[model samples]
Structure formats: structure tokens, C-alpha cells
Target: MQQLTIVTPQPERPKRRLPKWLKRPLPSTEMAFTSNVIEDLNLETVCESAKCPNRTECWAQKTATFMILGNVCTRPCGFCSVPKGKTGEILIDEPERVAEAAARLGLKYVVITCVTRDDLPDGGAEHFYECVQAVRAKTGADVEVLTSDFRGNRAAISRVVEARPDVFNHNVESVPRLYSRVRRNAIYQRSLDLLKQVKDEAPDMPTKSGLMLGLGETFDEVLDVAADLRAVGCDMLTMGQYLQPSADQLPVERFVPPEEFDELGEQCRKLGFSMVASGPFVRSSYHAGEMAAEATS
Candidate 1:
């Protein structure tokens, strides 16, 4: 039997202190409706659950991607802070609540994602579709489904794509060689195939993917990923530095400077992506709609 190394590396301390410009103010803008929407819907969000640094900024703007299915994911990925094991049963009414939240928040766009439901036969694809439909029905906003591989279920993937969300997103997270270290039970080629399938299946709806750098990935690998994404017809690309949210999560390899991020943006543009969100703090859904709109224009 092959012995799994399972080396739990210590979280690397931030190389430098936060510059004044990098410091973010606390979130004082409370949207009571936002709280009510999430509470009423009983949805789990990476913002609140994973302790994303931008949760305050995103929520203060009255925007949040509704995490459906359940908060608990089936896979215990090395880099993720989301708790693992024992994902609860699918919530039938969660879709309605997400729609109600989007409608109540007056959101012009809604981004939805979920934990990987490996136990489910369809890998929660139908559930993602139902939520997108409900959000559209209730809010009438352009929807973005930031999804998983649906465990490579083509029919399940089609069900979500056929729902026709304005944007379809599936993040590759990192380069192929880092797959075992970054994502558990997720194949790099399979993920690329998912993006390819989205491009083939839903040509009109913009397809997007993202990767987190500073995970020991090289400049060449980053460019290679950009080429691969463009090859799969991914319309938008986001590259950001990996910030370890917790002690147990993956550590940052090296702090990438903002200039390097800018360079990456230029490389992404050269690789055929019209839109590239590349920065130390930029995330896939941060200003997603506005950034995506630029690509179409």
C-alpha cells in the first residue's frame, strides 16, 4: 500500500504587515434584510462560513452568493477551510429562500454555489438548477452559477447549464501538478473538461474560471493555465493570491506582489481572455458582474 505523506505544513506567516492602503475598514453597513434573507433561507455561504476577508465588503454592497445544498462538503480538500463530513440532506425549500433573498436585496445579479455532494447521484446539479430558476423567478436578475464538476455527470451538468444562468463558473483552483495538494478527489483535466463542456453546451452565457496563485505555482504554470482556460473557451479569468484562512488550511508559498498580479493580467489578456481580474485581493465573484460586462462590451 502506498503511504500517503499527508504533510500538514504550518501556515506561513504573512511576509509583510498590511500597508495602510491594504487595511480594510470593519463592515458597519448592516443590511437587516440580508441577515433575514440568509437566516430565513437557512443557506450557508463561504463568506460567513469560511471567514472570507471580503465578506464585509461584499455583504455591505448587499450582494452574496447563496451557497446551496448544504454547508458541509463531501471532500476534505487541503486548502479549503469549509468543514468536512456529514453533509445534511438537501433542503427542498432552500431554493425559494435564495430567490426571496435576491428579490428582497434588489440584487441585479445573483451568484450561487454549493458544497460537493458526492453522495448524491446527480452530484447536486439538479438542486443548483432549481436554485438558479428560483432566483430568476423571484428576483428576475441575471444569475451566475459558480459550480462544481457535478462529479463529472454530463446529464447533471446539462441540467444546470440548460437553466441558462447569465454566467457559468467552475474554478480550476490551481495548476494540474498541485491538484493532489490543493484539491481532493478533483482531477485537473476533468475540471478543464467541465469548462469545455460549458462552452460547448452554453455558448452564449459567459463561462468563467479562476485560480489562486502563491501556492507554489510558477509563472510558466500560470500562463499555461491561462492558455488551457482559453482553450476551453472560458470567457473570464480571475487570479489572486492564496490567503490561508485558518491554521489547518493550506499555507501561502510566497507573497506575490501587486506588480506580479498586474503582469499576470497582461499575460491573461494575451492568452485570449477578454476579462481578467488579477490582484492580491481580487476574488472570482468580487465585482463579477461589472467585470464580466466589460468582456462583452
Candidate 2:
């Protein structure tokens, strides 16, 4: 006689869901107004291009971080969702358009950032200066410029420093160990040099750098990066959880809990960072105006 045998298949595990704290209500009318203003002036923003999780909330508050020098980026960083490709013609009218958008929105403080434009001679430094000047001329609002490293071109960095934006921010994006995988084509030392150069050129100008966590970096590594920034006279720091923009980008290794962020923020403050913003939803330009004001004050 033969014995009968039976086997049952195992069920697949469900995907990890975003925690409750990350959820938000649907867009409001204020968001619609912010979108309309940006569209009317034909301007671009990092919020829309990067698929930032805080876009809905920031727009609903009638605030946005404008992205200049065209939305197409030259670098293909693994963690970013901004479109990357060959450079396009410089939009000569972009500065004025950004000014108009800021004026229409009644923004008291404007934060302007740009995609990496390595193809250009100065990495768009002169354009950044013009945009800052135009915004100041139009709205009389304090302007903050978050710029690329300009490939560590001293002349290019000096140009923007001379423009005298209220704050000069360049994000390190990740710790040194993860730079190769997280920020391709970016050198960790070069970024540090850029921040140092900004401070050296204009000691009074507040310099800022940011990092995204949850990329397999240990807690000590993040603090070490902060120490490096502090060594170079970085005046402000922003830490945030890295979220995958799409399937093609790097997947989230972990969803860092809010309490951990709070601990990191406290640690950074003890390291002497004048202003620190750390949390799941924090972005380089998130609450940028408030950070600038508080840091400078």
C-alpha cells in the first residue's frame, strides 16, 4: 500500500505600508492657488519635479521652493527623482518669472534651488545671482539660495557668495560611506570644500548643508557627517528620511521613526548647529524661510 502525501504553499508577505504620521489630508484650495500662480508665470519648482512628500502641505500653505536653471538635471543621483538628461537652453526670462511668482504669492521669504547644471561654464552661478537679485528687487523678501557644488570651481562659488543671499545651502545628501551608491558623480570632500569656501569667502554668510537618512547608514555615521559640516563652519543642518520617488529609484531601506529623528535633532544641536530640522517629512527646502530666520536671528 502507498501512503498519500500533501503540501501547502506559503502566502506572500504584504508590502510595508507608510506609517500613520506620514499620511496627510487631500490637497486644499490654497494648494490650487499656489499651483495656478506657478503655472501662470511658467516657473518650475523642486516640489513638483522631485515628487516631495511635503508638496501638498507646503503648497496648501501657499509656499513653494522654486527650481531654476531648468528642471532637467545633469547628474543622475540614484536617490533623486528630478529628470536627468542633456542640458537645455538657458531660460533667460526665468529670474523675472520667479520674481513675478514670488510677488503674486506674497512670499516674505523665497527659497530658490536648481538642478545640477554641469554642462554650463559656471554651473549656472551667474544665473543664481541674477535670480536672487531679481527676487530681492521685486519682493524685498530675504532670499535663500540652495546651490550645487559647481564641481568645486572656486570662481563659480565665489560668484554666488558675492551675490549675498541670506543663506547659502548645499546638501551633502548622505554620509561618506554611502556617497558612492547614494549620490553618484558627487564627491563627499568636494561638497565639504564648497561649504567651507562659502564661509571663507563670506564669513558672515550663513552656510547650510543637509543629509537624507535610512540609506543603511548607522547613527554614528550621521553624527560624524554633522561634525564634518560643523568643522567647516556650517551654520545650519537639515536631516530627513529618504523616500523612494518611484520604482526606478533606490528603495527605502527603513522608515526611520519620528522619535529617532527627535534624538538626532537634539544630538545635532549639541554639536552647535544653529538651526536643525529632522523628521520623516523634512526636505532641504522644507520650512526653509523659518530656518533661515531662526538661524540668522
Go through the candidates in order and give the C-alpha RMSD of each one to the true structure. 4.3, 5.7
Residues 1-297, candidate 2: write the lDDT tens digits.
999888788864344578887777776556888999999998899999999988888998899999999989999899999999987888999999999999999999999999999999999999999999999999999988999999989999999998899999999999999888899999999999999999998999999999998889999999999999999999999999888888768878888999999999999999998999999888889999888888878
- Which residue pairs in model 1 clash with each other? none
> Which model scores highest in lDDT?
2
- Candidate-wise lDDT, in order: 0.85, 0.91
Write down the RMSD of candidate 1 (Cα, Å): 4.3
lDDT of 1 by residue, 174-291 (tens): 9998988899799898988988988898787789999988889999999998999999899999998787878788877877888899998998898888799999888878888898
lDDT, model 2: 0.91
Q: In candidate 2, list every pair of residues with a backbone clash.
A: none
TM-score of each: 0.92, 0.93
Task: Show the lowest summed lDDT stretch of 10 residues, model 1.
Answer: 13-22
Q: Judging by TM-score against the true structure, name the best candidate.
A: 2
